[model samples]
Target chain A: MSEAGVSTLEIRDLRVAVEGKEILSGVDLTVPKGEVHALMGPNGAGKTSLGYAVMGHPKYQVTGGDIIWAGQSVLGKPPEERSRLGLFLSLQYPTAIPGVTTTNFLRAALKGQGKELPAREFLKLIRSEVAALKMDQSFMSRYINDNFSGGEKKRMEIVQMAILKPEMAILDETDSGLDVDALRTVADGVNRVRGDGMGILIITHYQRILDYITPDRVHVMAAGRIIASGGSEVVAQIEESGYDPMLRQAGIEAEAAASAAV
Target chain B: MSELISLRPMTRDDAPLAELPGGDPDFLHKLRTAAAAAYRESPWPSSSRDEDWRRTPQIDKLDPASFAAPGSSATELPEYLARVLEGPLAAIGASHTVVTDQAGNVPTAGGSPRGLAVPLEEGLRQDPERWSALLGTIAHPGLRKFVALNTARLTGGALVRVKRGQTAESPVRLVHGVDQRSAAFPRTAVLVEEGASLTLVEEWVSPEGDDSLLAPVVEVQLERGAHLTHVVHQRCGSRTVVQSTVRVKLARDAHYDLRWALLGGAWQKTYFDVEMLGEGSESRASGLCIGRSQQHFDVQTLQDHIAGGAISDLLYRVAVAERSRSIFAGLIRVEEGAQKTNAYVQNRNLLLSPQAKADSNPTLEILANDVRCTHGSTAGRIDDDQLFYCESRGVNREQARRLVVEGFFADVVDAFPQGAVREAARSWVLEALDELALSGALAAGYGSA
Candidate 1:
């Protein structure tokens, strides 16, 4: 890879462990400004762990290696600091805060980043975003993710992404629980916010979401490490032959691999 | 039930019971005389020994005799009290309101139930027999030490009554305030005659920086087919201490809905006794408490199903910060032969600081063979996952904690009437959390826990 620049996030042989068990073992990757990288793997390839580690989740301990963002080390920063530094992580299963309304949560998030909008302006912006996402207006009043459908949750994540306008976002299986229509709407929301040199890493198990938002680079992970890296050919190869051929090529059996780590 | 003889005869040196105002009816005098005897017979509750006072360490230090006698009516309302009246109280549109301060009372005449709803003293003088029979019928002086003291020193309170077959459009407000280094014992009696309905809001407030003791007792009687909505809002100064009890009885097919908000006091111990006396009676009780600074709160509630086919539901929530402590103990008792009874009790506590402590205990005593009863309690800190979720969205830990705390109390407050009452409660919760944040308690939330 080219020399890491100020507008790039470099994972230098990144290693992460959860509950004293290593999940990501010596994985290296880089995504430059304005580029969308697709990180795909089979059922348990530690794809989500990479997103969490990069965002500084307390449970996802960085046992070794370094994560450099914007030409500075972010290993010591808390998750909020990481977010303030223009990083976002779309959780696969968003937590439901029972009584916190969606609009209030978004407003607090904006204020945390020193971008607080006036009440009327904020409501106007949220209304436009909700309309664009084909979401119901009542979503703003409902508790965040409480009793929401799986598709609605995925769309809600995208709505936050659109509002937050982060520099770098890691979408962890955002397309896992969406139908065709919701997937398109979610993909459109992500694409609309993919401006201002915002880099994205979309993690997925299926190639369907990639059909809408093309990836600059596709990387396959196996046994807690990236086994292969290429362009659209990687997506086609995995879609046609599945991950068995790639797992065999990397000299690792598919089922025996201990990648089922959260 | 302990046999403890009085070392001295009842006098002003021991308490203010003997100094009660004269010209009272024989029943009123005899009631106070009997309560004084009971007060002398019982000793102050010991924190270590008394099961009910186990979690309350402040109870052991209480000395009611050290404080001044019960307050006289106030001639002028303080600025703080006036502000409250012009704000939340005025918006409530109470049909009858009587505001009491340390000096005296200022009663406002409303649309209906004019003479029927008056001060407790006036009510007693108007109908001595009726007032005598209703007073202390539910919250008997023998119930506890404080109850006896309250009865002996009872001076000024509101007596709100709705005649049979009448429905009051607005609430009846009994607003009481106390001064620094003083004591207040306000007794309220709310009577809803058969097929009548009424709404009552009792607010007890103390000015900031005051160190006082306020003990209030409330008795509620809902006759058959009657409906009553009762709201008790207690907001005291940070240095004040409080001991309060509310007793409610429901007749056949009667309904009692309650919202009890305890938001202040340096140390507070409160009791709620809801007895479903008649068959087909129903009760819904919701309570919320926000504790900060060095505040201590111990709230106890009982849902008694005395008759068959009654229903009772109770939910209480508490949030504590700084070095505050909150304790909740609730019991649902179903008597034998009260078949087909349904009861539910739940208590949830949220600790916003490592130094903040909360303990919740929910128990059930069902002697009935065919009854459905459930009880559960939970005490916990903010969920790490939830905090992380908010943090990942650029919200700091402190702000995230405020949101979580607000969300924790929303369900209970959301059930309140959607107007001034609910808005006032919501603002108070926000203000309390802001205070906690200012004290740097929110910074110590995720550390070491």
Candidate 2:
């Protein structure tokens, strides 16, 4: 976790869609490595599309524009290729695989990165990570997210991010449905793995998660584009006035600048 | 093919009764002779034509005459076959072991015939009276072609008897080694005396080649208050075609637990029938099948409750990948007046290849309203969200899919006969995954069929 490093993720004029319906239009964003950027927007502002488009999800088609990770473009790669290239996405909704365990999934990810660990050392790491997440040891042996509660799924995503040790992780609404206690615990998990040489882009609809992990930068998206970005003052203004005023001041829906560009 | 072993599609002229070994009473020979004549009477089952076989509708075009059912001399097993047999034994060390390699062949170092375990033929020769009584009423020859064939050309069978008020020191392990390109008809008869208990682990192996055809018929009788746990593990090569039928009769207060681990084969068809004959009887059946490539499996089962106060539960999980396919059809039948009967059946199938296909058909026939019965069947692909969750963690799509598929099967495999059996199952699954990975199937196989 390099707090002050040079690795960067620059998204210039990223346009994305799903089944020919455009979602993200001309979205400009940049998260230099070693920094936490809070991405806040209203319900239908295409906030999730950016996270998925950057992760190279097949469903989130990138109709135009570039996603620069480190120094090269990765717009055409598969999700696995993007993952191996140090990009990660923590889905708000994780799929349940009936019999696959977290331990095996983690091992598979490590192998994908050309890394293998001794069983003893691997167990030791798993034990420590499980404890850090306040999860039972049995959780590692249980099937991945199979019938898991909302909080358990959140903790699972955090544990995976911590273990996979990605350089940049696009957390798509990681705090969506969690209570305050679980939210704090998951926030602490993010903070623990925060400064380990990776850039953090926290996408959310509420300001609660911001209370724990203070963002170095805050970007507001509306209708599909990043209409405003600034320091923590932007978050304070949004909280004080709500997203309506911000969208109104930016004239996001009048001319529909985001859609017209697409 | 030998004259005694390779009698292709039975003609009335084929005289199997005179070829089989043993000096049983004339009635025994008469039964075999009648069975052979019945084999000639029954027509071959066509998947596309027969009502009972219509659900699966998929099978290998195997020639019955080309395969042989040669018997061994009851001596030491060959190294290759022994190597396959020893893995399971070492994993689940046996209290008594028996093999059908040859005459005087001691499958185990010190298996006692006087007590619990004995060779099939020796047990038949030693107590010709009891073995005949049980085999006399097992599978009927005229009911189906495969049954008739197995009855007409039976070889290399075993009998494990747990006497009353006695429990085995360890599981009685039975291992069968079939030669490549030959057909073998094997049978197992398990008789648990009243209040007796035994666990039998029977394994079938054919070395890695498309060189054998295996057809087996098993009969289990659980007397009043008797208990038995039978685990059948079949892991033959994909080249071999295997079809097995198991029939069981549970008496009053008797409990029978049967589990099948169908891990390998090019073509596999299996059937299981359990009849609860008296009150307070119970049975639990479970199985898991993991297949890839061009493998095909046709699985069916029937739970017939003839008396009151009997309970039966069964679940089977199947995973098919590549161009493979699986068909599962199960039924729970509660006879009229058989009230107070509780039963449940479920079949789950997973598809991982675009070309892979699966069909799950679960049915119920309840003539008694006082009975409680339910059946469920589902065929689905790997969850997209789960696959994404895995891939998002830096695992490639292929490995992620494989992990999810293995997880799908672990639910059924992990809970049974926990120690060595579970470990062997996991190891077998990994071996299969390795084969799939090396063939470039992990990435190239998934598609919507």
Candidate 3:
């Protein structure tokens, strides 16, 4: 009942709401094999809400939609179940679990996915990843996301994504509140994880991230629906002109269609 | 088996227990008479609608008719204890001293002080002047019926004294062996003089197939500027019942640290009462309890701040598996005019099975305006998200659960004093975990020690 592709993720007519308020309305998106799609939307445009709904966050209710992943329906699965289905969402605000170290947390997640790396090999991978992210090795010993700086927290999210290596990855505002160097390092990590088997959905309000990790297709979202779809040039246009012009154009088209129907 | 059946019922007529070297019959009589009077005047603690004893209903099952005075000598310790003492505790110059009855005996190591391991009857006979002021003062005044019973019927115990300005480099270990199928009451009293330091460990063990009752009372006194570390390990047999009470008194500028590890017992109840009676005193009390099967463990603690400028901190961790249950109740009281008193109490429990149960109550009573006091209690299971996170990394479900449980208790384990005690405790904990894993109660892939 869904489009066929080598890609594992298919979001069709996805409508999401939070507490009886529609945040994402009739949003149709597709992330095919070996491609990265950047979702650009201003504040309160339902960017993060979409990411949460796609990843099966309990709070984000999908009133009307279906998420088909890898030829299977994943709409009713829990977060952990979705994770096992090769879907991952890097949270904008990671939760701090005291008494649980990052190393242990990742090891559990990996084990849940039916993969067990030896302790030494696991440590080696973590060390290399930490080095690539320009993070200290001691961070692995600390509690997960406990008392971490903003940039360090972002790097931790990327590190988790790299280690988990899900088939479809959604980064929720990963570039927000990061300095230039930090942002660049995060983008590099994301780039390293990108490949033919992986499809990334980078959600952000700013276009600065596009400069580091260019997307094959840029989708502009306004008031919950995808208003425009274009190449990388659209990101520059939105950065220069903001959402007002495109929002006005969308409104004009809606009125014209309504008059013709009457 | 014949010896166990042929054993005569212990009574007051059984010749008075032996005295320590330089043995006073008069002082012994006086102590016995006073304790007997206290027992007669105090009523036993009953579970008939009383608030404190309601949750622990087995307290009322103790029939006074079944209790007999402790006999002289009767049971053998398990081989595992010998192996443990030789392997870890021995490395720190510590040796085990087992007391079968009132016959007070120390190991051949010859490092222990002459009067350190004296029995209660011996303390009364040999050193009445030094023991009289300490005998009943530190313990509560017939706080519970069993405590009164212990004072009334005690035959033997360990009397440890640390001289002024002296520090024992190694721990002094005492094993209180409760034998026979009847009630046995044992007592222990310790005295640490000014500027002296000592570490004392007491273990209560019951041999296999012995369905016995043990009521124990222990008192500790810390002189001005003295430091004392006390650890109590209670691991009775599954069919055994035990009731224990420990009271500690700290003088000005003295420091006291107490750790209680409850591992086994069919039904066990313990009370820890620490009284900071002098200014500038500090006390730390920590405990860990693990219960499985139908075992029940209850711990009640009180941190009474009677003097100004004294501080106390308490932390208790409990884990329950199978159908076992654990209860922890802690109260910190800062008396009026005890200004600048700082006290905190935290109790955390982990439920490993659906049938397992845990109840934690942490209370603070502050009568002073300028004091700082806080108490918190938390009961939860392993975090599902954390478990999934670990499992996703290739750690199986069981191993993931084990890691999470270990992490839960790591905060308390890290607080243990360094060296042999800490190592021994860690090894024992790992052994318990391994047993669970092997029994398939825990998941596979979690390696054992």
- Top model by TM-score, which number? 1
Candidate achieving the largest lDDT: 1
Pairs of residues at least 3 apart in sequence or in different chains that clash in candidate 1: B72-B103, B73-B103, B73-B104, B74-B103, B74-B104
Candidate 2's C-alpha runs over 4 A off are A1-6, A254-262, B1-15, B18-20, B55-63, B69-76, B101-112, B445-449
Task: Please report how far candidate 1 places residue B1 from its true position, in Å.
Answer: 29
Tens-digit lDDT track of model 1 for B1-449? 11122223334324435332334466766777778778878877888999999999788778776666444455556776776677665788776777665443554434232465787767777777777888888888888778888887777677878899899887787888777877778788888999999878888888887578888889989999999988888888887788989999999999999998888788998999999999999999888998888889999999999999999999999988878899888999999889999999999988777788998889999999999999988888888888889999999888988888899999888867668778877877787788878987776535343
Deviating ranges (above 4 Å) for candidate 1: A1-4, A195-197, A253-256, B1-22, B78-80, B101-116, B445-449
B1-449 per-residue lDDT for model 3 (tens digits)? 21232244433322122223233245544554555556656555566767677678887766644645444443343353444345555555553243433223323334333545554555555677787788777774456666666665565677777889998777777766565465656778889999999888777766556577777889999999999988777767787788889999999999999887788778888889889999999998888887778889888899999998999999998888778888888999999899999899999998877777898888988888899899999887776555544543345567766777777776666566678777766665666677667765565221210
Tell me the TM-score of model 1.
Answer: 0.93
Candidate RMSDs in order: 3.6, 3.5, 6.3
TM-score of chain B of each: 0.93, 0.91, 0.88
Worst 10 contiguous positions by lDDT, candidate 3 chain B: B12-21
Cand 3, B chain, TM: 0.88
Q: Candidate 3, DockQ to 2 decimals? A: 0.23
TM-score of 2: 0.92
Q: What is the lDDT of residue A42 in candidate 1?
A: 83
By DockQ, the better pick of 1 and 3 is 1
